[model samples]
Target chain A: MGGLQAGSVGAFKGRDVISILDFTRSDLEELFEAADWFRRRLLDGNVPKLLDGRLVALAFFEPSTRTRLSFEAAAKRLGGETIGFTSEEAISVAKGESFADTIRMLDAYADIIVVRHKYEGAALYAAEVAEKPVVNAGDGRQHHPTQAMIDLYTVKLLFGSPDGLVYAVLGDLRYSRAAISFLYGLTLYKPKRVYLVSPPQLRIREEVEMVLRERGLPYREASDITEVIEEVDVLYVVRIQRERFPDPMEYEKVRGSYRVTPELVKKGKPTLRILHPLPKVDEIDPRVDSMPQAAYFFQASLGVPLRMALLTMILGVYAG
Target chain B: MGPVPDSELLVRKIREGTVIDHIPAGRALAVLRILGITGREGFRVAVVMNVESRKLGRKDIVKVEGRLLKPHEVDVIALIAPTATINIVKDYKVVEKRRVKIPRLVEGVLKCKNPTCITRKKGEYIRSRFRLVSEKPVILQCVYCGTLLHEDEILAQVLGEQE
Candidate 1:
């Protein structure tokens, strides 16, 4: 499954990595291997402490819960010290320091910067001006490469491999950057089928469809989650990002197109695992959380290993 | 070639000035609306419209005698007509023949990005700073609301705002 993506990035020298698409199959494979290696060392109690003196700085211009804590956890586990803002309310950024200058200032102090900003391409902009390495924790509604990495890693861990798998991605395809990056990342593989379940107004973008065409990955969409739930090997759910939408009234119109519950899974396949890049509002009912096939927790758990792999690869902390 | 056809652009040269050539047709007014051109008496101005250009289908040129367009004005013009070239003419010899470069931090080229932020749907001053994120792909960031503006959409929107 990992081919040119593995190698095009010859020896990772801590470059400015902003998107998962920048990585080849070879690069992903290397990342996965390095992360799995780190995961093994911690579990075995002979941890090598490869990045003891390294410092990772996080600058988040928006509110975050899981992403902020999870990225900090990933960096700390790598034997690196971390410092940053979970929210922008207290920073000098609130007093009108432009993003470029802030990034430039951080470049002198920190070895790597993991930033989440509200504006699209802000991560790319930070990566552009900074001489040190920068990673996109998530940027606006544009890309979430690390989260997509965790999602794919969870699929691999669960099913052994991602080859010839059919998955149903439900809810808010248009405004959900997670869904967009997930679908974009998945399309790089030859998935058997991808059922994009969203309302009529929130279909996967044509730009997304064009990338699917480029990779020759097959896909289709439906308004009903029930229509394709039985056929999928996995059911990936995403919340409609109401905050990303400028108008609240538009969000009201498309809120209930798909709702997952234990009742919805009554006769569902035992092997059909459900995944959500979460902070889920009502899309996945709480009753569904206790079910045997609920993999969102496990999905979230995969973030550590995946990001450990990602950080090591990008920073060259691992034995090459 | 033959006395530079029509030659209505016969304003006297200055020791130092900028000549903006090949602006798209019907945009001379917008360019003139830029600072120091409309009511200021010192800077001599030359406006030529309906000129021939295979690239623009039609063109206009504004030559400012004894002055030059500011960095802000160049950013404004680059938003409208990327092909419009700015020449720094000193003593009738040309230098710096290229399209105006949009600055990374822009002021006075646009308004707020929010629909409800009192700029999109109203007549209030559509003024804001912008940051250039990508040059080839051309994404602009609004300073007020931090929205990334798709390149041509805002350019077209500003065209409507001018009228």
Candidate 2:
């Protein structure tokens, strides 16, 4: 309440959540405060049905667990209904239905759309086709705006704010849309430093790197996580996706190159928070889950309230 | 005139078409492409490449016989050849001449090389739109995907058909 505009109604009403870059530091700060408000409400067992009588279409052309379900849960928790498909076979897309036509169909039914697809610009395309706002759950290996929102919100909850936190983004920097989006989100705030930890072949994409350089964001590239492990306040890890690799041999080469273990966490600061966009494969050690430094489960839990805030704000129902 | 330059002699003067002068050397073919003159448009096109210029060390020139250049075509020419001057030929005389200026937004002229760009979708028919980000190296960002296209990529897209 002290941070953002006071009592401004529907600042983000019907706006498309296509890219993390679309929001400024101030916008995100306002959103975090809203998320905190929702968190408190949920904790008090007083859920506000801000999105009552609303419809959300979940158009997931690619396979997903967290993103799809979290958006669905977010809508329902706000007294909103969810529609749309999880796979192509569940819809007309399997029958050679065009992406535009399918989106148009959803637009007629839903008040808003949350899209996840294997193609990079699919969500942007959907936003173009639909009159309703489109939220990008994940798109190709480039963008996952809402996941970045939850990640940043978690960091804010744990460490006061994401500002001035030395972060080491570990694992797949090139092929993970969640990782890419998180990096983009960091540019909205002032970070002390960001250490990009990835294998040589999986370094951050050239365009993403260019954006960081343009923003004058201080960052360093390290092939191994241990290089900056001791210095970072946060170690954000992501799975090295085999499905993203165009070449099977290339995937084999980088497979298991980076893994977060209890031993690795020991190298970091005592107060270090480890985060991952879940449904991870072998990249993280299960034994490390019980460690005090592990914040991924808590991070995942924050997704619900964060998304609930997002839904209400997008629908112009966030009176706060 | 001080013994007409050999480059000028290469292509005879056109009676009722536009003459594009000072295209960057070796890019006359690309200029022709942006104009959609594929040598099959039934218009006689004379391309002169590696022509010596005092301003530009070397240049290419494209002369199309009987068609006036469109504004969009001029916009694209500015992208590849910023210093280019367009001369309108009418009744066997130069009627109008102007230097090309790069437009801020280019739409439906060049295909975005980003295969995943919304404009590149098979059945969407979304017109490719690009914003001019940098002028020196000629960088363009796809309005849909935010993918950057450097000079090489921009050239390749301009040369491809405008489908």
Candidate 3:
């Protein structure tokens, strides 16, 4: 956090939050500092009404519950309003309206747009169409900027910094946007090593691996989680995305391929923390949820303040 | 330049058209497709393939009669044939000749191979767009999805084969 003061938040004003790669290390540091400030203020029962008259449009072309609610909750806590549809079927898109038209409508209605879509570049397309700042809640198989922010903040909260930690991103590396964004976020810092664990069919994309190499980040790819289970400081898990598989048989073959259990947790260092962008399906055994290593719930809760930090900065309302 | 080989002389010189010489061997069809010169276009086209050259070992050359290429068409040619030299023939003399230079941005020539990319949506009316990210290896990144298209993908898409 060295020269990154609250005033550094000015750079983010009216900027689109579409990809983690767009952010620099100091930009992340500034955001994390703001999130930390919001976290403390919330605990003290002082909810700032900084965005008193602003409106946040949630244009989710795909279905989502946790992400939609957290954004709504975040905006409400900041005394802002939230609007827009959760699914394509719930809006004019069901009548065959174009994605750009949908985004244009949201832009007309709100100050900032939070869009989630099944297509990979839908958020980028929305940002292109809309006048308002666009935040990508998630995009197909690659970007989830705010989720990655909360995740890095969680790591910072636990280990005091995201740097110099050995991380293994387990499960659907190919199809999981959260996992891929987390990987992209890791490139912003210096990690000791990262183990990409997935079945060969679901291996990390060559393009992503190329970026990781370009960043000079140390990494290894493995088929099994146990290869680095004992050495990793953080095990970031994501569910196998069944819907993303073009063939049902391919989905069936990799389903339940990796699981975290209490016995499996016992093999790791006591300080090892486990994280998942949840609504998981049979990936993490319910028994492990009670363990000290289960930091996913705490990670999920931090979504509020992290998003609050983002909204305030993007809306240009952060006086500090 | 010593002498033109017998194979190179098979397609006689054009008096008033364009000669695209020194294309990477076996890429003449791709160059034709980039130029939209399907045999249906009815222009007198001579494709000489695998001609021996000191600089390129073996290369393909395309000589078109009664046709001049548009700038954008030449730009697309530069994508697949960086070593290609475009010579505007006038009265059987090479009036203008210049090696192809890759453009800073390319549009509608190559499709993003990413199946889930928004630009691939059926009714979106979005044209494919790519930025020239690297010239040596010929990398094109989709402006929408940020998916990279290397030389092979670019060639395939330019040849009208879907990935």
Tell me the DockQ of each model, to 2 decimals: 0.08, 0.59, 0.64
Candidate 1 on A1-320: residue-level lDDT in tens?
Answer: 11123333544566666666766666666666776776677678656656688888888887887787877877787688888887667887677666677778888888888888876666766766777778888877767888887887778878987668998889888777788778877865668999888988888755456556667778887889887777888889999888877779888998876799897776568888999998899998899999988999989877776776666666766674
Instruction: Please give, for residues B82-149, the per-residue lDDT of candidate 2 as tens digits.
Output: 88999989988999898897788988777877676667767666788888888888887877777888
Best by DockQ: 3
Q: Please give, for residues A1-320, the per-residue lDDT of candidate 2 as tens digits.
A: 01123454555667889889888887888888899898898899888888889999999999989888888888998899999889988888888889989999999999988998887788887887888888888888878999999999999989998999999999888888899899999998889999999999999888788888998888999888887899999999999888888889999998999889899899889999999999888999999999999999999999888999899988878876
* Model 1 stretches with alpha carbons more than 4 Å out: A1-11, A95-98, A205-217, A266-269, B1-24, B31-45, B50-155, B158-163
CA shift at B40, candidate 3, in angstroms? 9.9
Q: Grade the docking of candidate 2.
A: medium
Chain B TM-score for all candidates, comma-separated: 0.73, 0.84, 0.88
* Model 2 error, position A259 (Å): 1.4
lDDT of 3 by residue, A44-83 (tens): 9898898899999998888888899999988999999999
Question: Clash totals for all models, in order?
Answer: 9, 0, 0
Residue A202 deviation, candidate 3, in Å? 1.7
Model 3's CAPRI class? medium
RMSD of 3: 4.2
Every model: Cα RMSD to truth: 6.7, 4.0, 4.2
TM-score of 2: 0.90
**TM-score computed on alpha carbons, candidate 3:** 0.88
Please tell me the interface RMSD, in Å, for model 3. Answer: 1.2
Better of 2 and 3 by lDDT: 3
C-alpha lDDT of all candidate models, in order:
0.73, 0.86, 0.87
